[model samples]
Every structure is written in C-alpha cells, then in structure tokens.
Target: MSAPLRVLGIESSCDETGIALVECAPAGEPQGVPRLLAHALHSQIEMHQAYGGVVPELASRDHIRRVVPLLRETLAASGLGLEAIDVVAYTRGPGLAGALLVGAGMGCALGLALDRPVLGVHHLEGHLLSPFLSADPPEFPFVALLVSGGHTQLMRVDGVGRYELLGETIDDAAGEAFDKTAKMLGLGYPGGPALSRLAEQGDPAAHALPRPLMKTDNLDFSFAGLKTAVWTRMQRLEAEHGQPIAADGMARPRADLAASTQAAIVDVLLNKSLSALRRTGLKRLVVAGGVGANRRLREQLDEACRRRGVRVHYPELHLCTDNGAMIALAGAMRLQSGQAVAERHYAFDVRPRWDLSAL
Candidate 1:
C-alpha cells in the first residue's frame, strides 16, 4: 500500500480566509472522497459589513492577518505539524486580484519552505466539487449547479477536470441579485442570508416578481431583470404606503417583498436546474456555492427532484460558501484521478477572471 497524501489548502478568494488539511489515499488506491482532517475559516463579514459590502483592500489586508493564525489553528485541531503535509494548494482565480494573490503567495511560500509540491486550484471548480465533502458524496456523470457571489453556471460533470458548460448567467448572478435586492430593501450587509431569513416570515405570493429566463428554452440564467422588478415593486410599495417599505417598525411589508424576491430567484434556479437534468438525461444533481445554502432553494429543489425521481446533493451548510477544504479536496481528487499534478515550481500567478468552461 502506498502512503497517504496530506494536502494543505488555503483560500482567500474574496472576503473569507480559510485553511484546511485533507488526507487522501495514494493514486489508484481504490480512492473514495478525501477525508478532512481539520479546517478553519475567518469571515470578513463584520469588517465589510460596516462598509455595506466587501472592500477589496480591506479583504486583502484581513487575509494577511488571518491566514497564518488560521493555519496554526487547523494544524493544532488536526494534531499534525507542517511536516505532515505532502502537498499545498490554493485558490488561483476569479476573485479580487489582491485577495487571490494573498492565498497564492502564501501557498507557494509554504511549499518552498516545506519543500513540498504545490497546486493551484480553480475557485469555481472547488465550489463545483464541494459536495464531495458531504456525508452523501455524489458520483460522477451528474449535472452541477454552481451558484455563488458573482457566478451562476450549469455544467455537466463527468469526473474531476471533465466539466462541460451547459448554461451560465448573462448578467447579474443569483447571489449578486440577492445581495443587490437586499441592499435596495435596506437589508444589512451579507444580504442573501438576511433576505432569505426575512422571506420565511411572509407569503411568497404577496407581491408579483419576474422570474428571468425561467420560461426560456435554454439553460441560461438572467437575474438582472429580477433586480429591476424588485426595485420597481419596492417603489410602488413605498408610494402606496407614503413611506419607505423598510422603515423602522414596518417588518411585515419588508418580509413580504423579501419572500416574493426570493421566490422569483428560486423559481428560476429550480426550473433551470431541472431542465438541465432533463436535457442531459441525468438522474443525479449537485448544487454548490453560497446561494446553495438558501433554505427556500433547497426545500423547493428537494421537493421538485423527489417528484421527478432525481437525486439532489449539496455540501454541508458551512461548506456552501468559499472555504479551503473544497480547494484541498479538489486538489486531492485531481491527483487521485490523474487530472492534475502538484508541481515543484515556486513561481505563481493569479487569474482575476477565469472561465470554468475553459479549464
């Protein structure tokens, strides 16, 4: 039997700094999902919240402060030393350039210091495969719905590194729409969760909102129109009430709008995901990324997929957002599947804009 490989993963793609260690069996050794030894994450939500959203420079600086400490925490939690890691991995792109660089630089430096090979992981690919960390990991040859802060994509996943783009967003991504609409409704920063929580208090049919591209023949998504529709509705509501709908002590109307807005987004995602599955004739579906954590989306998708006899999978709630465990797991899976290799080279680069389909 070959020795186990320990992978240390670092993620600083946006507002979160995460570090984790994962252990995988040697290549071609009857591989299963990699085991997460320990992981730690530090979210910049509080710091960025004061600014209404993430400030790039603040995010970068915070990553600098938190990465090393979080690394030590992960190692301590796992009862492992740096010497135990055989490979190092980091998120390489499609994020704030400064934030991406912080992780990339740390990863390469760690590899050089420890004399270990390092791998650069695609950010979205990490999200796409994150569900493997769940108790019910998925098998290959399934459809994937990747919905995060700035990206909404549908893809066919045959295996590690074998992804085919089925459809994608043409304008605002689902998460982006959620945040923007939340801001318009006076919801606080990190608005998606807030909006979703509020939505639970009101009727989804209270206000009519557009579901962009829901009835379209293709799998593509569009949320820009939905945001506009929400804005118009809010304006109408304010005019009718002679005050802002989000005014203090006016929680009911806000909840209703939140519910209606959430319904529109979930309706589109649910229909499009089902359509993608039907088009590919796949029975299994995997949903990943921040927006995947939305309760309404999960509930609707679960019921819909159950009626259709399709299996749906998602990462554990905490893993739905950006995290290092996904990056390490992706690297380990790639090595196990012979899709990528950890390299000895120390020079590194970051891609602020990467197309997942191109990988």
Candidate 2:
C-alpha cells in the first residue's frame, strides 16, 4: 500500500503569509477529507494599517521575510520535517504579482530541495474548498459563495475541480464595497471589521440605503452603486454638521450610516445566495472567504437557510481569512481526484488577474 501523501501548502496571496501541512490519505482509505495537521498564519494588517491600504512592494518584501519562519513553525506544530512532504503547493494567482511570486518561488524551491513535485493551486479554489477543513463539512453538488477581498462569486460546486459559475459581481465586490464605504466613514484600513463593530451600536434602518440589483431577475450583484450612495450620504452628513466626519465612530450619524451600508451589502449577498440555492435546487451551501466572517451575514444566512430547509456551511472563523490550510487542502483534493498533476518543472510565473471560472 502506498503511504499517505503529506502536502505542504504555502499562501502569500495578499497581506498574509500562511503555511499549513495537510495529510491526504491513500486512495483506498475511507476518509474523504484531508486531515489538517498543523498551520500557521502571519497577517500584515498592522503593517498596512498605517498606510490605510496594502502597499504591494512592501507586502511582497514582508512575505519573503515571514514565509520561511512560518513554514518552520508549521512543521514544528505538525511534528514533521522536510523529508515527509510528498507534494508542495502554493497559491498561483488571482493576487498581487509580487506577493504571488514570493510564495511560488519558496514553494518551488522547497520542492526542488526535497525532490518532490509541486502544484499551483488557484486562490479562489482554495477558498471554495476551505469549508472541507471545518468540523462540519458539506458534501458535493452544493452551492458555493466565494467572497474574498476583490472577488465575490457564486458557484455550483459538484466535486473537486468541478465548479460552475453561477453569478458574480459586475462592478465592485461585496468586500470592496465594505472597504470603500468604511473609508468614507474614516474607518482605517481593514475597514470591514471596524465598520461592523460600529454597526453593532446602530440600527440598520436608521438611514435609508439602496440595495443594488435587488429587483434583478438574474443572480448577479452590483455593489459599486451602493458605494456611490454611501459617498453621497457622507458628503451630505458632513455638510449638515458643518464639519468632517468623526473618528471615534461613536457618533450616531456615522454609526447609523455604517449600519445602513452593511445592511445593504449583506442584503444583496443574502438574497442572491438564496436565489442561487433556489435556482440550483441544491440542499447545501458553502460560504467561504474573509468577508464570510461577518457576524451579520452568518446570522442572516442561518435564519434564511433554516426557513428554506437548506443547509449552510462555512469555514471556521479563523480559516475564513486566507490561509495555507485551504491552499494545501485544495492541492491535495485536486491531486486525489485526478484533476491536477503536481509538476516536476519548478520554473514559475504568476497571474495577477486569473479568472476562476476559466479553471
């Protein structure tokens, strides 16, 4: 019998450097989900907070410094060494060019050093399969909602590497809308969380906000217009107060605006997701990505799915953000399903704007 394959996964897609080890059981084994042995993640939120956004060059440099240490930490956590790995996988694209290069270079270097094949996993595929890492994972033929930083897409996932695009954002994604609106409120970088924190103190209906594409017949999304609405509201509020917006976010007006913006974004997401589930007649739904960690989105989804007799699955809160576990799991699953082959050729390049549906 062949030994289980140990896959080392590296993720340096944007502002996070993640390393994780996943063990894929031999094909004969009954276990379908790859076992997550150990993982480590380093977030550059603090570093980028000062600039109120990520600086690509700085992000790339930081990934170089952090990737090695994170790999060592992951190995230590897994109680394994370099020789045990059979395959090395790294996020290949749909991210910053420099950041993707850092991870891809390190991963190929490791593969060469260890005489193992290397695989390049898609970033969105990583998120799409992330829920499989959770304690309660969903089965095949499920609807998947991928809501990462700049990407907001709904897909019909039948199995590993079998993804059918359902609908996606026409303009700014949901996460982009959140950040853009939060910026208008003077919330610093990584504004989604900060804005959500303030929204807890305000009412969603305190201010009227437009829900774009709500009446549309199709499942597509449009958050860009909602951002313009938020900007207009902020301008009007500043003029009404004869001053710039407050920084504390405790002011009722700002808090109300934040809540309204969040409600608008979440409303579109929720309605579109439900519409997908109905359209596909799928019983299970999996939501993945950083924005999936929003408390409001989860709460509303739980309630709505329950009423519709639909099952909803999400990656653990910690795993919702980009991480190596998702990337590694994606690689392992693809190989196990015979959908992708690990390459002996280590030379690499990155696609900054690769289309997930193309895969």
Candidate 3:
C-alpha cells in the first residue's frame, strides 16, 4: 500500500491564524474522507474588538506573531515533525490582502524548507466542503448554503471542484447584516454572536422587519436596506425614550429589535434555501460558514428539512468559522480527485476578491 499523504494547512485570510494537519490516501488508492490529525487556531477577535472591526495592517502583524507558534503547537499535538508532511496548503483568496499574503508567504516558505509541494486553496471552497468533516457527512450532488461575514451563496455540489453557483447576495451577506444591525443596536464589535444572544431574550415577533427579496422568484439576496431599517428603528426608539437605547444594559426595546432583526434574516435564509432545494430537486442540503452556527437558522432549517424529507448537514460548530483543517482537507480532496495538483514553484500571489465560481 502507498504511504498516506500528510498535509499541513495554514489559514490567515482574516482575523484568525489557524494551523492543522490532515492525513489521507494518495490518488488511485482506496478513496476515503481525509482525517484531521491535529489543529490550533488563534482568533484576533479580542485585538480587533476595540477598533470596532479588523484593521488589515494590525491583523497582518498579529498573524506573523501567531502563525509560527500555532504551527509548532499543532505539530507537537500531532507528534509529527516537519518532514512528515507531504503537502502544504493555505487559504489563497477573497480576504484581506495583507492577511492573505502572510499565510501564503508562510506556506511557501514551509514548502521550500520541507521540499514539499504547496497548494493554494480557495477560502469559500474550504467553507463549502467543510461539512465533510462532520460526523454526519453528506454525499455528493447536494445543495450548499455558504454564509459568512463577506459572502452569502448557494451552490449545487457534484463533488470536489465541481460546484454550480445557484444564488448569492446582491449586497450585504447574512453575517454582514447581523453585524451591521448589531452595530445600529449599539452592540459591541463582533456583533453577530452578541445579537443572537440578545435575541434569545426578546420576542421575535415584537417588531416587524422587512424580509428583503423573500417574495421574489429569484434567489438573490439584499440586506443593505435591512441595515437602514434597523437604524431607522433605533432612532425612533431613542426618540421615544428621550435617550439612546443602551445595548450593554440589555434593555427590552433593544432586545426586541435584535430578535426582530434575527427573525427577518433567518426567515429569508430558510425560505431561499428551501426554494433552492426545490429548484434543484436535491434531497440533501449542507450549510457551512460562520452564520451556519446561528441557532435560530439551524432550528428552522432542521424543522423545514424534516417536513420536506430532506437531509441537512453542518460542520461542527468550532469548525464553522475559518480554520486550517478545512483548507488542508480541501487540498487533500482536490489532489485525490485529480482536480488539482501541488506546485513546486515558490512564487505566490493572492486574490483579495476572487470569485468562487471562477475556480
């Protein structure tokens, strides 16, 4: 039997620096899902929180400090040396340019030092295929809903590297809507989780928010207006109270608005996802990316799919956010499926705005 291929993956495409190792059978060997050996992630959320958002330059410097240590920690956890890795992979696009360069440079340097070929994996592709790492992995030809801070897309997945774009956001993505709306509500940085947590306390039906593009026949999404609507509502609340609504205090009005905002987003996503499943006639649906971690979204999708007799899959919550394991697994799958090959040339470039459909 041929020796198993070990891949070391690096991800520094944004505020997090992640490193992981995955093992899989080489091409023409008995095909099986790649197994994650060990992984470590360092989120720059706390560092970026005070600034209200990520500062690209700061993020780049932080990645430089964190990547090497995280790599060593990952290697130690896996009990593997630099020579054990057969390939190196890193997230190559659709993120902060500076952040992308940090990972890409590190990946190439490692590849050169180890004399192993390197592969650049698309960021969205990593999120799209992340569900395969779940305990209940879905088969090929499934419908995929990829939702994150910067992207909101639905695709038809036939297999690795065989993706068909179904629909996407025309303006702000679901995660962006969450963050923007949270900001309007006076929530702190990294607003999505905060908004979701506050929404749990208030009535989802307390306020009526528009569900953009929900009634339209096309699956394209629009959330820019939703942010404006939240802002307008907050202004009205302040006018009524004769003071600004405080988010830290968890005021009833703010919580109600948060609930209403979350309901609107979740409703649109659920309806559109179900519509995509109907349009494709696919019985299996896979949800990946950060917003896939939303509890309300998950509950609605679960009930909706159950009624429709469709199967739904999601990555483990910890893996839903950006991580190196997904990048390594994507590279391993691409190689095993003959979809891509690692390159020996060390010269590297990054696409800060590459389209996943273009791949």
Candidate 4:
C-alpha cells in the first residue's frame, strides 16, 4: 500500500484567490479514482467590478491579504493543518505578473515553512483539468477549448505536460469580444454575464452579427472583427436614429441585441470546436476557462457535440472560473503519475505571458 499524499493548492492568476486541500493515494477504489478533500475559493470580482475590469496591482494586493485567511479556513474545513500538507501547488504564469507573484510568493513560502514539495501549475492547465473535479471525469487524450477574456485556444491534451496547440484566437478572445460588445451597448463592467442574462429575454434574430474567421480552413479564430462589426452596427444605428438614439430604442430591446450577439458568438465557438473534433478524430471535448460558465455556450455546445456523436465535458459553474481546487487536483494528478516529488524550492518566478504549449 502507498502512503496518502495530501496537497495544498493556491491560485491567484487573476482576480480570484483560491486555496484547496486535496488527498490522493496510489491505490484507487475498485474502479480507480482520485479523491478530493476540501476546496475553498475567494473571488474578488465584485471588488474589481467598479473599475470595469481587474486592476493588476489591486488584484495582487487583495491576494496577499486573502491567501492566508483562505488557507487557514480551508485547512480548518478539512480538519487538517500546515503539517498535513505534503505539497504546495500554485499557478506560475500566463496572468498578471503582480497577481502571479502574490500566489507564487505565498506558495513558496508555505512550502519552505512546511518543509513540503512545491509544484508550479500552469493557469490554463488548471482550467483544463477543472472538469476532473466533477463527479464524472473525462478520459485523457481529449480536445480542450479554453475560451476566456484573455485567451481562446484549442489544444489536444495527451496527458499532463503533454499538450499540443491546435488553434487559437489571432486577436481578441471570445470573452473579450463579449465584454467589448456589451460595453458598446451600454452594459457595464464584467459584461459577459450581464450581457448573457439580457440575452435570455432577447430575440435571437433581432440583429445580424458576423461570425469572424468561421470559413477558414485553419482552426485559428479572430474575434477582433466581431467586436468591430458590433461597433459598426451601433454606429449605423446611431446614424439612423440620431445621437444617443431614442430611449425606447435602447431599453429592454437591448435584450434582443444581446441575444443576437450571444448567438453569433456561440455559433462561431461551436463550429470551431466541431471542426477541431472532426479534424482530430477525437470524440471527447473539454471546455474550460471563464467563458465555460456561459449557459448559452454550454447548451449549444452540448447539442452540437450530441449531434456529432462526441462527448463533452465541462467544469461545474463554480469550477469553470478560476479556483484553487483545480490546481490541487492537477497537482495531485502529477503526484499520482510520478511527475512530482517531495522537495522544497525557494526559486519562484512568475510568467505573465506564457505559452501553454511551452509547458
């Protein structure tokens, strides 16, 4: 019998500070499965919302203040403490430098204090593995489509540390396009959710929006044109209706615009994902990152995959966003796979702009 390995995971790649305690052993149940002990997350979305988007410096400072408390709370919730933490894991890159530093610094410090091993987890990898935390985990060798405010990528995940970049956005990511379009239509900060909510009451055909780069042979995406198209349409509307437009023209009817915008975005994402699946000859698809929580996107993707005879996996809505549990789960997988060991390291560097393929 192998000893149980317990890990403490920390995440601060963006505006969220998450701390989780997870346990894994070499031996699984009869069916073979990993175990999660306890996970805790602290989202600073509301704190940064007044500013329109995440403010890097503020994000870092908030993480610094929250990590310790969250860690303590998570340990308490798990009925354990610093001594039980066998390894300390944290996100290393592909986020704000200041924010990454906060988590990396705290994680390394904890590792040194606890005399435990330290593992650096990639931000995107955490997102990619988030679905594994669900009741039913997907098998390996699946296609992962990570669509977020900062990234839109398609990858073939062979295994941990084995990832192939399939395609990605050439300009604005899907979430970026969402937020920008929402702002253009006078929706406030963090527009994706707000815009999506309004879209529910909207008419899907109220406005025609272009789906950019959909016909291209390559899997690469470009949402910059989509944003531009929204702006152009808005300009035409203004020109036709005079400056500011009539209040009635811009009120709840905005819901229809939101619906049309969301439909266009969903259409592009679904087509691209299906194309990747068809090209890869793989039947399993994993959707991760912030945009993974978009209800419309998930529904459409689910239907499309069903029609195409492919299985789709998604993180629970909470896990869909940034969180520490995913990092812990990813780190535990590493330990179980013999990719990591018990060691202490003080050398920690944060990569603000890292290529997922580089890992």
Tell me the TM-score of each prediction against the true structure: 0.99, 0.98, 0.99, 0.95
lDDT of 3 by residue, 88-134 (tens): 99989989999999999999999999889999999999999999889
The whole-model C-alpha lDDT of candidate 4 against the native structure comes to 0.85
> All candidates' lDDT scores?
0.94, 0.92, 0.93, 0.85
lDDT tens string, model 1, 1-359?
88899999999999999999999997879997899999999999999989999999999999999999999999999999999999999999989999999999999999999999999999999999999999999998999999999999999999999999999999999999999989998998999999999999989999888888899899999999999989998898888888887797668888999999999999999999999999999999999999999998999999999999999999999999999999999889989999988999989999999999888
Residue 73, model 1, lDDT? 99
Ranking by lDDT: 1, 3, 2, 4
lDDT of 3: 0.93
lDDT, candidate 4, 133-235, per-residue tens:
8877899899999986679999999887788999999999989988988888777778888889888988988788888989989989888887887777777
Ranking by TM-score: 1, 3, 2, 4
Which model is ahead, 1 or 4, in terms of TM-score?
Answer: 1
The residue pairs in collision within model 4 are: none
lDDT of 2 by residue, 1-359 (tens): 57898899999999999999999875456547899999999999999999999999999999999999999999999999999899999999989999999999999999999899999999999999999999998999999989999899999998888889999999999999989888888889899889999899888998788999988988888898999988888888888887777644338889889999999999999999999998999989999999999999999999999998999999999999999999999999988888898988899888889999888
**Per-model tally of clashing residue pairs:** 0, 0, 0, 0
Model 2 error, position 85 (Å): 0.5
- What TM-score does candidate 2 get on C-alpha atoms? 0.98
